[model samples]
Target: MLFPIFLLASVAAAATGVIFKPGAWYDGLRKPGFTPPKWAFPVAWTIIYLLSAAAATRVAGLPGAGAALALWAAQIALNTLWTPVFFGARRMALGMAIITTLLVTVAAMTVSFWSLDRVAGAMLLPYLAWLCVASGLNWRIWRDNPAVPRPAA
Candidate 1:
């Protein structure tokens, strides 16, 4: 029972990227230096999601899982929204702003989860680290490609 719940969380997170068709937009971009290989993202995210699910499961049994879950949901919504903002809408600058918000929220979630379950909080560390790198990348991408047109509404 617990395993499935965790899997659902993992699947939900995994599906967010796919729902936005991240690959197609990602492939179209002129990535900045140090952009990890295309393959790296899936692998990294898969591991990250699995760890997150584990953490979530741990937290689920605790008292604050409700709040933790709410925070997690909010972060995931922001996470999913970024792909379309950056890729679909071609608004890297705005996407950067959105991702920044996501990062802060995730950090809050991490702290909250830590209060409930230390291991769960620890699981989110890598996610926060990745977002830090991604935020920097988003800023650079927007800066370098200032001339790129924002996709029409």
Candidate 2:
């Protein structure tokens, strides 16, 4: 049961990427120097989400797990929103800002999880690390592509 929940959460996380599949929508932007290959995102996120879910499941029965779970869910929602905002909506600047916020929220949530169960908290470390890398990448993308108009609406 726990495995399925984790799998589904990872899949749910992946579904967000579907919004960016139409290459026409993203062809105009300049990628950062360190921008990862297209194939990397899906693999990285799937693993991260699965690890996060595993960590979370271990603490499923804990007293304060609800708050930790809520924070986790909120961060995931924020994480999912980033792809659409950046790639689908083409709002790189706004996406960078949002990613920054998400990064902080994930950090806080990680600590919350850690307090509840160390293993669960540790499970989130990879995701937090990736978000830090991502935040830097997002800022670089915005900086490198200064001329592109911010998405309207």
lDDT of 1 by residue, 3-98 (tens): 577668567767766766655555666668877777888888887778877787788877747988888878877876887777777788889899
Summarize candidate 2's per-residue lDDT along 1-153 as a digit string, tens digits: 566775677677678787566275455566666777878877888789888878878877789788888877788788878888887777878899889889888898889988988888888898988888889988887787777765577
Q: Highest lDDT among the candidates is held by which one?
A: 1
TM-scores for the candidates: 0.85, 0.86
Worst 10 residues of 1 by lDDT: 21-30
lDDT of 1 at 85: 76
